[model samples]
Target: MNRRTLIIVTAVVAVGLFAIGGLLYSPTSKEVAVTKPVSNEAPLVRPHSPVFGAKDAPVTIVEFFDPACEACRAFHPVVKKILSEFQGKVRVVLRYTAFHPPSEEAIRILEAARLQGKFEVVLERLLETQPRWAPHGRPADSAWSLLDGTGLDVERARRDAKLPGIVAVLNQDTADVKNVGVTGTPTFFVNGKPLLDFGAQQLLDLVEAEVASN
Candidate 1:
């Protein structure tokens, strides 16, 4: 081969290897999810689960997610996009599956935000600043500071987060998570059907199909 051709070939191979290495080391690659056929819908939604769309929407996406989960953080935008595309026809119900130790604290903060009717705002702030607080195995203590300008009364949220009611919400969701056979974060259920073939496209397709059927 000519010197120029060999150089180009080497560069292309390097790029390909780099891309492959990125995929292998990505946080999503380490996520372990186990989904069983959902025959019962009762455990999917509770009255207190955070809902992020029209309450009467025909299609429901129940997401069991951990706030500190990297995979869940990565999929946040995808979930938002789906909600936007299916506006008024689809709703997202957030189920806190606090798989990470730090996740319970985040979930408590979210539950507190929900009390002040600022769930979505606080949720967006947390996800946007996830890397700062939640860095893999480390504790997400910095997550509290990231919510400063989200209009959530931090003092009040702190107090409310310890309430029995808040604990009840967490406990109930934990039980439902086990009942529904969810073993990981970002597990989605579209119209009571589990997304067995997992992927962003698969989730979108499932939502689209449910929306069309309804």
Candidate 2:
């Protein structure tokens, strides 16, 4: 071959060898993709917390409520409305912050009802008759009567309510209440984000926004 042609041929061969080497040493296209870390949000539900909705729902709303608080009663229907609207998209986790005089007893009562698999019914009945049971000052003794037909087995509940497990649940919730800076009943959180401003409309809007984003 002529000198110039030989040099050109050598250069082409060298380039081809380099290209093949690069392909062999470099990572495959599928293996070279950047990977992002998985997000792990703080847990919103506790073992003792009461849950409403699908167990593995995308959105969680944690509510610190006082059973004796009239505002809690008022907001109960609103929360139900929001849940109904969202259906399976959201779940509510109820935590106790028993500020009222009878609120602790109410919590104990609910805990007892939970043991009997009657948590929902007793909760509904308690809220429905909160005024009568958890009135101003000392709770009226008449409150016990309201639980008669609630499938609560009031006597059993009364005994179980004082047990260590229920007491521990109440104590832990109280501590969390302080840690979370819950000043009053019906305080709400959506997806570990606190409700900065308190209002029914504000809660609904926040929930709606979370639902849309998720």
Candidate 3:
């Protein structure tokens, strides 16, 4: 090849090599940000949520509970005993995890009772009568009939159950249930720590650990 041709070929090859190097090592102008899906699982406790035991208790047991769950019914007394034992050291924040036909209606009834300052009594009554009213696949309307004259203004509660506030509460709790990975009723979270293995004793142990830590 002629000298000029040789020089031109060398220049082109050098330019190609530089371009390849630039591609290999240059900082990219276009930033591809791969964002991961963030968890929306906030605190299980909300302002409108149902709380039992001392309001100022340092430790909080957040239970993702379904009113229709027979297991939840059984755990009621055990939870009560734990609260009695913990007393001022812990409180429970109940979030609805309505996994059955009667669960949502039962929550609505309980909230209606809350509106009428009868939450505790109505909750007790419903838990006590859950077998009759919350049996598997039970229609919600039949359960509503049972709530009548419980000092809840049952007719009014049936109406109020459709109210925006109660609905929003239920919807939010349902979303939280999925977000927090709750697959069953009576799922417990002690101060944001999930009960990895579920049992009455596990719950008590977690609560005691949290209470002691606080």
Which candidate leads the pack in lDDT? 1
> How much lDDT does each candidate structure score?
0.77, 0.72, 0.71
Displacement of the residue 64 alpha carbon in candidate 3, Å: 0.4
Per-residue lDDT of 205 in model 3: 83
**Candidate 3: worst-modelled 10 consecutive residues by lDDT:** 23-32
The C-alpha stretches of model 2 lying farther than 4 A from their native spots are 1-44, 137-139
What's the residue-level lDDT of 11 in candidate 2?
A: 38
Stretch of 10 with least lDDT, candidate 2: 23-32
Looking at candidate 1, the ten consecutive residues that score lowest on lDDT are 22-31
Q: Write the per-residue lDDT of candidate 2 for residues 105-142, one digit (tens) a residue.
A: 88888889999999999999998898788767654766
lDDT (10s digit) by residue, model 1, range 63-111: 9989887667666666776787889999999898888767889999999
- Model 1 has a clash total of 0
lDDT of 3: 0.71
Alpha carbon deviation, residue 7, candidate 3 (Å): 86
Q: lDDT, candidate 2, residue 94?
A: 93
Kindly report which residue stretches of model 1 are placed more than 4 angstroms away from their true locations once superposed.
Answer: 1-39, 138-140
Report RMSD for candidate 1: 8.7
Candidate 3: segments with Cα more than 4 A from true spot: 1-41, 137-141
